[model samples]
Target: MSTPRNVQQLFDLTGRVALVTGGSRGLGLQMAMALGEAGAKVVISSRKAADLEQAVMTLQDAGIDARWVAADASKPEDINRMVDETMERLGHIDILVNNAGATWGAAAEEYPLEAWDKVMNLNVRGYFLLSQAVAQRSMIPRKQGRIINVASIAGLGGNHPMMRTIAYNTSKGAVINFTRALACEWGHKGIRVNAIAPGFFPSKMTAGTLAAVGEEQMAAHAPLLRLGDDEDLKGATLLFASEAGKHITGQILAVDGGVSAVTGG
Candidate 1:
């Protein structure tokens, strides 16, 4: 057998390519930055060109090799086009981060069908299509890949009484199982699938939730007694995207500062 690689070498992502969806902001951009910082060339995608442009500049300012594509993850045509464009530009994708998602607030008994469909389509179905496209177009042939799906601690169980995001919570639960099932099917193809179940982090998507639930109250739910900062996800993202996690698959890692452990949440 060959000697083991050193920690730094194992974590290095040089020469690899990554595609991150919903990457213009929030948790998605955080993960993109982590991958690029570790030496992978990264392509960030979202529906709006303006947002992608700004995000690309931010990544570039940090001295990362970054590019952007504009596409709505919920649309199949867009998913195909995004993957094709990424492949055309970078030649291959070694990592795919399924981070685009949507959430709707409503009491379960009063939820609108349109709202439910919107959340599920973007959060769950989008992940499936994009992963399938990337795998078929790149990873399966190469026989090696890393897929990091951004799930949520909400998937662990129900949310606080003040929260009312039935569709979002359900979609996340699906994502958790989707990660596991895909890992099982793709392991033989040398693809490792895992998920990062983040708790409450302040972002555009969570702004309303934070206000509704009260940031301090939300933080108090976690043993760490703090909401996640910009840097909280970097280490976990790097671990899953790098060779350091080569043997890990079908796992759901909670980056929630012990919230899930304490509250199943």
Candidate 2:
């Protein structure tokens, strides 16, 4: 018998299905495209129907099988429907990317309770709840799936005095730990859970900061001497979604271009 020619095929995702929350724009859209390019049928969801439709078109134009579902991660009913619809439409969700999140900025002393609750509700609570629903309903029964939580470097360190976003930092910090804890519990079930902590990327969330300070500001603190570009997300995301990362779980992979290593340096 002859050996097959398909060597190094661990990264292929030809028959998988992926569900990405907040996939209408920014990093979520980027990751969705990456997965689609890797041969997975992608389901993108967000609070806005118009944007989700537009994203679907964009992904389709790229020759990728993409669909859209409008749902707010913060709402329990919406979360349930999102998962249900994905399963009903796509048949099964082999991968779940918890990328829908928000941030509010205000000094700690002046931060309002409402703001904190809002941020935590979606970033931490919603992320975990949606993951739980998916795990119990789809992954646990099949005993196979991958969950990737999008976190931030802000979670790895204390608040930067330059920017006051206490609630955002706290929520991201919780997400990192949440990934670790959930991976521990779900690993034995053949479900791999992990997190990706990205550095400064040019997205709607960072538009204000990047415009106000420019690339010089981002490079000053980052060891890479440059802000994150669109292509930076592809490799890290594909690694986790593919067999290349089969042994990795409960890990927080920092794709921040060496920013996490600097400590008051």
Candidate 3:
């Protein structure tokens, strides 16, 4: 027999609380809005208080119950404070989105050591540390939680000759494996760890590169002949956050417009 349907199973998140790092703007804000639209109370955090305030207001104007906290993900103390404050205010955290990241662009031969460390510190070290804090504080005791890390397609394979981001690419690759490793260890604890590797999207991070290369050229390179849109992130994020993905873990779900499938396009 098939499963039965009830009001409780309608992808409703009536009392869930979500903490989204880097939610002040870009893809982080988009994911926060999606979670709020699904009925979860969202806490958005970033290094800039101004941006966080603006984003909180924007979410409120849209009828979502949202709050903001200013913290640098790259700083361990700040990350700890953010998680503690979220718990204090929200009472519990059911979902955590590690969307904070940094990227650097330089040729492999000439990549600055400082640039490499900065990227790795924020993208890799900060990500793991924040996730650890959340897990220990909430997920571990409850024996249930959802963690989503925002990686990139650069992590999947080497970039084309036209683009180069050695540090960013390497950091993302670490994130991908980290997701799998943590999932393996925590699966028995009812904690799900997964990653989203997005393709080209119009975000501040990609703006300079896209402008330099031109959209036409970028689109032509993608198999879908286009970049990712806002809506592309909504469904996947919801799936992992909601019961729809209750059995899935350690997955690297790509939101690319068919870019990862091409061998040589």
Provide backbone clash counts, one per model: 0, 0, 0
Model 1 clashing residue pairs (backbone): none
Clashing pairs in 2: none
Off by over 4 Å in 1: none
lDDT (Cα, tens digit) per residue for candidate 2, span 1-265: 8554352478888999999999999899999999999999999999999999999999999999999999999999999999999999978889999999998878799999999999999999999889999998899999999999999999998855566789898899999999999999999999999999998898898776677678687778888787788788888898888888999999998888888999521
TM-scores of the models, in the order given:
0.99, 0.95, 0.96
As for model 2, its CA RMSD to the true structure in angstroms is 2.1
Model 2 weakest 10-residue run by lDDT: 2-11
Runs of candidate 3 with Cα error greater than 4 angstroms are 1-3, 6-10
Clashes of 3: 0
| Alpha-carbon lDDT of model 2 | 0.90
> Clashing pairs in model 3?
none
lDDT leader? 1
In terms of lDDT, which candidate is stronger, 1 or 2?
1
TM-score of 3: 0.96
